[model samples]
Target: MLDWVASLPLWQATIFLFVVVFFRAQLTFWLGKFMRKGLIKSKFGKSGQNAEEKRAGIAALEKYGWPVIPLSFLTVGFQSVVQLGAGFLDWNWLKYTLAALPGYLAWGFIYAFGGLALFRSITNGSIGLLIIALIVAFLVWAVGAVIVKKLRTNG
Candidate 1:
């Protein structure tokens, strides 16, 4: 799969990345619809609840929705999970798409170059450098994930 992705031309790669992100966003929306209701029931449905509890759920969902689309590239299962969470919270599809575009672009570029860089480094016997680059990429992804978490929490 990595070889196949690597073989794609730059334009094709960009288009593929965009399509993946867009479809993933839509998937999140659909998944959220069912899960949010279940979550609401689990949180406040079983017992007599005030309006405040419902409000809290909505508020949490709104705050977190933006980051889900952007950080979808970092965490293994997290990208899809966040998208679903946003959808369940009833976030606007447009808002999610906007937040996701730049981040996905960044991720796609990094992945494309990173793949080539790693292969070159290893082929040239710069194994140590290759390892370092991989670590750096991981760190960058980690930082991106943190930003996403913060945005989701504070927004």
Candidate 2:
């Protein structure tokens, strides 16, 4: 399957990546919905203590969630959370799909081409370079994270 994808043109690769991400995101959304339904059926949801608060929270999420989908796509480690949050909120399928389109395309193009090159690089005996690059990237990320934390704490 991956070999077939690798042989395709760039545009086709992008489409394939888009489909993959779309499927994954949709599946995540569905899982969120499933969990949400379970929660509603659970004892906590049955309790009326926080009914007003729950309603308000859902209202806020639905109202302010439009930007989150696209922004999450541009970040690391936050995409699944936002996608699941949408599903848990029972976001309209159409709305979620539309909001997520840009993210889909961005992720698609990035991974489609980058993944191919990355695979090729590894297969062509660039393992040493790949390892070095990975270490450097990790260091940069770690240093940047520390700097940001210190700035936040000291600012």
Q: What is the lDDT of residue 152 in candidate 1?
A: 57
Q: What TM-score goes with each of the models?
A: 0.57, 0.68
lDDT of 1 by residue, 1-155 (tens): 55776678876776676676667667766788777667668846556345665666567656644665676665444566666766776677678668877767766675665644564556576776667667757865885687566555654
**Model number with the top lDDT:** 2
lDDT (CA) per prediction: 0.65, 0.76
**lDDT by residue (tens digit), candidate 2, 1-155:** 47777678889999988999899999998888888888888998778636765666566666665777876675444688779988988889899989999999988887777755664566576776677567656855774476455444443
lDDT of 1: 0.65
Give Cα distance to truth, residue 87, candidate 2, Å.
Answer: 0.7
Tell me the lDDT of model 2 at 52. Answer: 67
Model 1 alpha-carbon miss at residue 74, Å = 3.1
